[model samples]
Structures are given as C-alpha cells and as structure tokens.
Target: MPDILAVLNGVSPAWFLIVAGLLAWGAPWSPVRKALMLIGPCFALLAWFATHETGVYGVIDLGPFQLETFRFDSLSRIWVLVFILIAFINGVYALHERNRMTDGAALIYAGAAVGAVLSGDLLTLFFFWELTALASAPLIFAAGAPMAHRAGLRYLAIQVLSGVLLLAGAAVWASQTGSWGCDAIGVDSAAGVMLLLAFGVKAGFPLLHMWLPDAYPKATGVGSVVLSAFTTKLAVYALARGFAGEGALIAIGLVMAVFPIVFALVSNDLRQTLAYALINQLGFMVVGVGLGNELALNGAAANAFVGVIYMALMFMTLGAVLHRTGTVKATELGGLFKSMPVTGVCAIIGALSVAGVPLFSGFVAKTLILSGAHYAHNDLAYAILVYASAGVMELSVLKVVYCAFFGEARHHQVREAPQTMLLGMALAAFLCVYLGVDYRALYELLPFGIDDYEPYKLNNVFGQVQLLLGGAFVFALAVGFKLFPLKSDHTILDADWFYRRLGDGAARWGKAMGELLVHAINTALTAGVARLRARLFNLFNPAGALSREFPSGLMALWTAIMLAAVLLVSYFSPMS
Candidate 1:
C-alpha cells in the first residue's frame, strides 16, 4: 500500500480529471458520464492525499528547457485539496443535467486550474493558465443564450489578454534572470507589474472585475455553479504565490472590499448579486495577501477554501430557483421556502456563512483577515473591512434571502431542487459548520503552520455579536424607513458601462464619423478631378489655341530659324 501510494505521489491529480474530461466527451450513456464526473475528483483527491511531503515531484524536459510540473509545497497543498473538493461537489450538483459538453468542459477547466496551482515554473503555469481559459469558455457557450455567447467571447478575450501578459512577463523575467521560476516576484519591475495585471484580471480586481457579474449569471444553472469554483480563486492563489506582501495590493484590496455592496444591495438578479458578493469576498482575501504575514497568508488561504464551499452553495440554491422558475429576479421570486424547503434552508445557511455570523466557516475565515489587518497596525483598513462586513455585506445577504425565498410572493410555483443538488448543498453546508468548529484542521493545511492562535476570545466574540445586532438593527431601520430597494428587474451597471454601453456607443460614433470623413474626401476629390478635366478640355481641345492648324510656310520658316540658332549656340559652347 505504501509503495503504491508513493508512486501515486509522483503523478498529478490534474491529469486524471483531464483524461476523464476527454473521455466524457466520448461517453455514450448519462450514468457513465455522471460517474466519470465523480471519479475524476475522487481519484484526484486520492492522489492529493497520497503525497506525504512537499517537493518538486514531477518534471518534464523539452530539449534544453526543464519544466517543473508539480510543486507540492504547503501553498499549493490546501489549494489543490479545496479545488478537488469543489470539483466533486460541482459534479454532484450537475448530475441532473445531461450536457456532455458541459461535463467535459467543467472537468477540464477544474484540472487546468489545479495544474496551474501546482506549477513551479512560469512556463508550466502559462500552459495551464491559458488552458483554463480555453476549457471554461465552453461552459458559457453551453448556456445557448445569445447574451451568453457574447459574454463568453469577452471572457475569452480578457483571459487571453491575461495569458499574453503572463507570457510576456515570463519572457522578460527569463531575459533578466535566465530562469522561469515562480516565487517572490515583487512589483518593482516591468515584468512584475505585467504579472500583477495578469493575475488581477482573473482575481476580480475593482475596475477589471466586470466579467464576474456579466458572465456568471448569464451561464446555465449548472454552468454558473461550475464557473464560481475556479477562475477568480485561481487568480487569488497566483497572487498569494507570486506577490505576497505587495504593498499596492493593500489599496487595491481595500477598494475591492467596499464598493460591491452598493450594487448587491440594489440588484434584482440573485446570482448576479452573488457575483458581486463574490468580489466582495475576494477583497478580504486580497487584503490578507497584501498583509503577507504568516497569519495573513493563512487567512487568505482559509478564506479561499471556505469561500469555495459557501459560494458554491449560494450559487447552487439560486441555480435551483432558476432551474424551476426560469428567473432569479427578486420581483419575480417569493414564498419559495414552502416548496423548496431544502434549497431555501441551504440559501439561508449560505447567507449566514457569507455574513460571517458566529460558528460558521465565514466567521472563522474572516476573523483571520480582520486579525491580520489589526496586527499590521492598519487601523483604518481594519475598521473599513469590519464596517463593510457588518453593515453592507450583512444587509446584502438579507436582501438575497428575503427577496428570493421569503419576501412577498410575486410569482412562480416550484418543486424542491433535484436530489443530487440537495446532496451537494448539504455536503457544503456541513463543511461550513464543520470548518467553523474545527478551524484548526483548516489551519494545519496552510503554508505556515498555526501556533496557539485564538479566534474566539471574549472581546472578539462580543464585538462580532454587537456587529451582528447592529447590522440587524440597520436592516430593520431600512425596511421601516422604506430606504432599501430590494426589488428591481435591472442589472447593475458596472465596468460593463465602460466596456459595453460606452464602448458600443463609441464604436458606432467612430464608424459614423469615419464614413462621413471618407464621403467628404471622396466628394472633394471628385470635384477637383472634374475641374481638372474641364480645364484640360478648354486648353487642348480642337477649338483651343494649341489645337488650331498653322500655315506650312510659317512652320517651316520657324523650324529653319530654330535650327540655325541651335547650330550657332552649339558652335559658341565650350564642350558641345
């Protein structure tokens, strides 16, 4: 058994899933495809667990260049485990669907993300990084919506741009150092900045984040669930790996943490709102990355791990609603708890976890970030994050829960989510509670091993309670004052305003101006040509001076005189 396990340690968990994904495309039966979905993640998890210690376990040679394929260090250990776990849960959530393309795409996408996390060199990372983009785009296409197709194209473009930047950064770094290793790249050089931008796009950095809301909600129900698991988190992992302790990330992360709550508070689309909330959660992780102490890095990793489970849960619930009711619009949803009791319960649990209520995964993970900020002496940042979590994030979660499941009934009668979906949600919800109770298990997996950390001191617990109570008070006040706009059919305008509305308008205006300029130039050219033609006609026509016939005698006399003059001039010339 030990020998078999040792051999397993050398192989990447990613290949099993990638191969399974390719096989899924050729699978003839639905049951087999579903089993394949479960098989890949299960086997991947097994392979991940088989590793007893960390090192560069797998290397590939390409002529003169050696590629480090599997760097199973402490940083990648937790990331790989969570990715495999989510991939399995995602598989279970999707068992009711019958789309082979989605099955193949989701598995390949998950594997590609894992491969990127395990990569020890820039060249290896670049290969898997771009593979993730190519593999996941198909999930958006699987939605079959025209909007989805357009969004998928945009998503692909941004991801390809990220890849281009990564490749360029790698080339520059290699030129400078004669190596392509992935470690401790500070943002002090061009290559480092380029690499930062590459990671930022996928991490949902503030201005670069429109893709999250624009694309995820537009994908199919199962597609949305799968989409939530990998991309942004992968970027977070990259940042943690390459640029930990980067000071600029502090400011960038602060902005990411705050602004999305406003949009989430007003948006009608449940999944879209959750997408905003996703960015909000990522902000906390970013702040942790920026802080970059042992505590801070652990916070970032734990948040990412817990985040996948709860976010996947919330997405699954809304997806179930969309599945049965065909709309996640707040105005169109209500009284769903009566029928979809399991899903509604799951949503509320997810909402609590997201709100960082005590004894949940979020509370445990989020406190680490708060503590990180506090310990760093960043008083302002700590205050703002706490305020965002208590006031804004809590309020947004309320709106999601109230509007989607318990508010005044507007329309739709629906059954509970399918059995597989419930099981997936239940599994995630269980983790949420389990991780909160046993956070030490999570800490043990972090890059820096934990030592006597206390998350549940009396002061911290009471402070959290006070915030929860205060947030509840604010929610009541908003409802009583009629200030909360919890229901609408409009999607929140975000960076898409610049990318879509303004960009489309600009393109059209440019095109129209271009055509007008071309037309005016052509008209001027035509007029000038016509005038030139008329002038030529007047000057050289048969009735004109040059065209008139001359007398032969006069012409011959002129020719003879010219010849005599030319001969006299040539005789007087020195060298003629």
Candidate 2:
C-alpha cells in the first residue's frame, strides 16, 4: 500500500499512462478502477506543467545509440497538452462503460501518442508510433463483429506497414547523417519519402485514407469515439514537426480537403460521414503545414487543437445516438430531436463548430489557415479552401443535421443519452463556443504566431458567413429539387476500389498465370523426354547402323585393309 508514484521517473508522463493501462486489468474495485483510469492523465498534466523549460528531459544510452525520450519545445508543447486534455475527456466519457479491453487499449493508445509527440529522436518516435498501432487495433476488434474483425486486420496491415516505413526511414536517416533527431526532412531523400508516406498514411492523405473511414465506423460506439480522437492527430503532429515547409503538401492538403467532402456528402452512415468529415479537417491542417510560415504553422497547430475537441464532440453525440437508437444510418435516423433533445442540440453545436460558424471554435481556427493562404497569395489553395469550407458546411453540418436529427419522426421511442455522455458532450460543446469567442486563449498557445493575423477580422467573418449562407441556400434548393445525393445502403467507390476490387481481380489473374506457367513447363519437359526417347531408339535399335549384322562382316574386311593402310601411313610418317 506504499505510494505507487514513487517508482515513476520524471522523464515523460506517458510512462505513467502506460503503467496505468497495464494495471487496468487488475483493477477490480469499481471506484479504484475509475480513479486509476483518471489519475494517469491528471498525473501526466502535472508532469507536463512541472517542467519549466523546453529541453530534453530523459536520455539513455544503449550500446552505440542514444534514446531521447522526452523533448519539450514550442512545437510539442501545445500538442502534448491537447493530447492530455483529450485523454482526460475520453476517460470521463468512458467511465460508465466497463470494457477492460477497450479501456486499456484507449489508455495505451493515448500514451503511445503522447510518447510519440514528446519523443526527441526518430527512434523514440518510431517505437511509440508502432505501439500506437499495436495498442489501438484492439479497440476496433473490441466491436466483436465480423466486419470489425476484417476491418481491424486491414487497419493493422496498413498501420504496421507505416511503422515499417518509419523504421526504415529512421535507420537510413541515422546512417546517412549520424543523427536520429526528429526535424524537418525534405521529401527528396529516401528517408524523407518513407517518413512522409508513413505520416501520410496516418494523417489520412487522400488515397491512404480509406482505412480510417472503413475501420472507424465498425468499431464499438465508444471505441469509434476514442479511435477517432488520437491516431490521425498524432500523424498531423508528425507532419507539422517533420514535413513543415514542404511545398508538395500544399497540393496534397487541398486534395485531402476537397475529395472527402464528396464521400461525406454521399455517405449513408452518420459515423462514416463523420469519418470523412475528420479527413476533410485534417486536409486544412496539412495545408497549413505545407504553407509553413509562422501564420500557417500556427494555423495548423490551432486547427489541430480545435479540430480534436470539436470532432470528438461530434463523435460523442453520434455515439450516444447509436447507443440509444442502435443505429446511425441516416436512412433510419430522423426526428431524433423528439427524444434525444439535449443530444440533438449538442450535436448541432458540434456541427456548427465543425462548419466554422461565427462564435464557434472551428471559425477561429479555420480562418487562420484561410488567412495564411491569402497572405501567401497562394490563390489556388485559397480558393479551394474557401470552396471546401462551404462544402464542409453543406455536407458535415447541413447534411448531417438534416439526415440525423431533423425531418419527420422515424425514431420516436428512444431516450436521451445517459448523464455521463451528456456531461462529456456538454463540456466539449462549452469549449467549442468558449474558444471561438475568446480566441486569444487558443491563439496564445499556438506553436508560433503572427502579430497582424486576426481571426475576427471584419472581412474574414463576412466572407466566411456569406460563403456558408450561399452554400446553405444552394443546398436548400438542391434538396427541394432532389439534387443532393440520396442516402442508401450502397457506398461510392474511392481509391480503396483498387485494392478492394481490382486487387482481388489481380490476385486471381496472377494465380491463373502461375498455374499456366507451371503447366507449360511440365508439358515442355514431357515432350522433350518423349523426343529424346525417339532419337535414342532411332540411333541404337535393330534398324540403326550399329545394330546392322552386315556391317560387322564388311567391317572385318575393311578393318584388315584399314590396319594395313594404318601401318603403311605410320611407317611413312616417321614413327614406325
């Protein structure tokens, strides 16, 4: 019964979280278990604030290598802090549930992410990077459905591949430079390319994003909520850390922004729609990282901070609906406001926040990115981003609200979410509005800053409001005319079609080709053996020259003559 915390080092708080996760299995008493679950992040935050300066906190030497476990800097400070906050919020939201596997995995996954952002070196980062994958896939499988199992396998494969690439990149980088520090790397190098892809896969970069939408919806309700919070944001932090200032990310970011809107618009499942919505938000951050100025980087950081909170709120609301109604299908959901009135209102706030309405967190955060794009005179990005903003409002906010909560009462018998869920959603919703109005709180915490950039600019607010209103008007028109994509159980194809559909076809074709090649080789060998047998028969059989009896008799006479000729030739040749 001695103090358990005495054993913890002051290196990084992630270790405490990891240990707490391990101990969750033995936590039998309900109150003690809940206390243990909440204490990890509380201690982590205490540890975070205890460090007064930005420097490497823990260093270890192993053979010829140095592992820097904790590095607090301007870049990592905000990310680590936000991760800790999200962990605490997720813990609170999950307190009512008693699934050990999901709870343990969530803690470990969060710890791994915490470790990753705080890692001072690529080696340390890679260790936690892989751990994030190992720890989180269980959350998906915890859903206990066949589809969840399959999606989990796919998720594991892709995530492990990312880890492999990370390890390779780290090794190559370390070999070439004699350093394993995590810093900005240009994609021109082999190490950089591998690392970019590794981060890209996690960040939901266009074609690499299907695993997220595919797997997240299949996870258990709470599992989906927790999964949505951590993994992708960790990747975004990596990009901000390592690939900032890489121009290619600008184009990559736009694609990330605009493409997912299409899928989200067409998606039938509320969770799936949110999955795509998450990608769309990541797109903005990716662009900010690509822009790489103080304003842009700040925008990216701020966007990430706000995005995590608002997105989690959205997921929480939807999770509540799923928990109560047993479905999140837009086709099946309607007039949920009748029963789950508080949940619906909270969800609407989350939607408005995500849509970047004035007086919401997303408005303040997303405006920074748009301002960066405009200031840089990257008109292409600027335009795409503006369009995407409107589109985001259309799909994520308007569409989600209409299909899930509004319209006639299809589901009339469900109750509002439990008090714990409502409490979690309320806390997050409060922040969404709080951060928006008093933007300085978040703006001051940005990794970097701009003196002149303002989220509350008259022109910025006016522009965003007009764009959203116009889009809403158009959406209303579209709905009136049945122009919007109708909801159905069917899903539209994306890059995953290559692997999901064409990949299977290619596999079948390759198998057939392999069979044909083996058969052809066997046929040729058999034919050659037969041909050889025929040739041998022709040469040595009774009809052949060596087996002819007349040849022997004639040969004897010829041999005598030949022997005489040989003897004469030998004598004449001077060797008798």
Q: Judged by TM-score, which candidate is best?
A: 1
Model 1 lDDT, residue 40, Cα: 96
Q: How far is candidate 1 from the true structure (C-alpha RMSD, Å)?
A: 10.5
Q: Give stretches of model 2 more than 4 Å off.
A: 1-10, 26-31, 508-576
lDDT of each: 0.87, 0.84
Which residue segments of model 1 deviate by more than 4 Å? 1-3, 511-576
Clashes of 2: 0
Best by lDDT: 1
Residue 543 CA error for candidate 1 (Å)? 42
* Residue 269 shift from truth in candidate 2, angstroms: 1.1
How much RMSD separates candidate 2 from the native structure? 11.6
Q: TM-scores for all candidates?
A: 0.89, 0.87
